[model samples]
Target: MSVIVGVATLTVVATGFSPHTAERETVHWSYQGSTGPEHWAGLSEDFAACGAGREQSPIDLPEDTAVGTSSDEAITIDYHPVTAKLVNNGHTVQANVSPGSRIIIDGTPYELQQFHFHLPSEHTEDGEHTAMEMHFVHADEAGDLAVVGVLMEKERGDSAFTDLWDRLPTEEGDEAQINEPFDLAEFLPNDRDQYQYDGSLTTPPCTEGLKWIVLDDPVSVTPSQVAAYREVFHRSNRPTQPLNDRVLTLVED
Candidate 1:
């Protein structure tokens, strides 16, 4: 498989806001101090959803609060081996995936756009944070977003990320070419049980109405592997947002 890296034509436009305009207006948000997540909405008018949106992302998943569903509702991921491009996009290290890979949820196919990482995880389980978190971002035909969140714990290293870790970019704006075929499906945990909810983007602009599928089981990674990624980014994560009136459904498989 061949993956291409370029700006996507379709933008994730919110009802009355454009994230592109926010990106252009406020270009200096960070993960700490006055410019952090707390100040995102105040930074720009386009980012009003950051503080105002009721259905925000990275919420804590309390097992007791989630309603269980049958295995028939499980999401179908169609990821395969593909040559991809890796880049350090200042905020996090992201892999721009090739076309064709997608995940079918309730019969709607969301094409894979990219995958990125966050240190010390973002979403917590019963208020417990994992070692790391991986986000596989996708988009439907209408440009609506769906994100698959995988939690990572420190233990034995998983070889599925060997090639990616070996070529980790050390600086902001730096990029590395992944000529080897990387199997994204192999990187995921074998169990596909996930907590499904409707939420907004965790980052700046905080666009809402996104489908969030956070896996229940966590994959293992070595402490050294976690350290390797941390060297590039000390910490890149947004705090958990309020769940509000949203219902979290556990789709068992």
Candidate 2:
């Protein structure tokens, strides 16, 4: 797929006492062609996993799986309302939070670093795809990465981000501050049934040894919300990767 990045915007619009960032943006990569996913591995040595890694991400989750109920396999998010820096990197709308937000599994704590989105989602469920996906990336003190994927589809009511939509960074390289406090839980679906697997970063420099947790229940988001993203990222998601020999463990709640 061919894509064209949008021009940056400088206007900071506000409504109902909430503050949002101005629109500024740039195109980061592509889905096809010389700069597309197919050519990512050759783009740099750091991205070799894009083509050669035995464990890649965005696998088609199998409906049947070994259920895991152990405490070590459970995920607990410890997040608080905080001001977030919303940036439009051309690839996706990324929200960067300050220290304090984290997720604890078993006894290890992984600090929430940042989160980004993918249009129409990159992962599939039984050969099916969600309207979009939100990846909440966290890392331990040792720098090991764990990502939480929340799939989204259209539904009733406005988004938790409805108040911040107009303030989203729309132009490439645009960095905007959301004056309103945002809660991570406000965006997650309540259903916690999920799948877990070891995989690489979905994007280049496709580093391996990362933990992927995908919630089975998708959160509700409208097409208009997705359409806003489509305007910035013509096509932002990487293609679903090969499953290779990896075992996907179902996280039973």
Best by lDDT: 1
lDDT by candidate, in order shown: 0.79, 0.72
Model 1 TM-score is 0.90
Give candidate 2's root-mean-square deviation (CA, Å).
Answer: 6.9
Q: After superposition, how far is residue 41 of candidate 2 from its true place, in Å?
A: 1.0
Ten contiguous residues minimizing lDDT sum, candidate 2: 10-19
Q: lDDT by residue for model 2 over 58-157, one digit each (tens)?
A: 7888676544665457688788876788876546678877778998866899988777788778888887888888898887877778889998886768
lDDT of 2: 0.72
> Residue 225 of model 1: what lDDT?
89
- Candidate 1's C-alpha runs over 4 A off are 1-26
How would you encode candidate 1's per-residue C-alpha lDDT over 1-253 as one tens digit per residue? 0111122111222111232342233245766666777887887686799988999988999999899999998899999877777776667778877788999988999988788888889999999999999998888888788899999888974556776888887776678888877788877999999999999787767888989999999988789888888777677788898888999999888
lDDT computed for candidate 1: 0.79
Model 1 poorest ten-residue lDDT run = 1-10
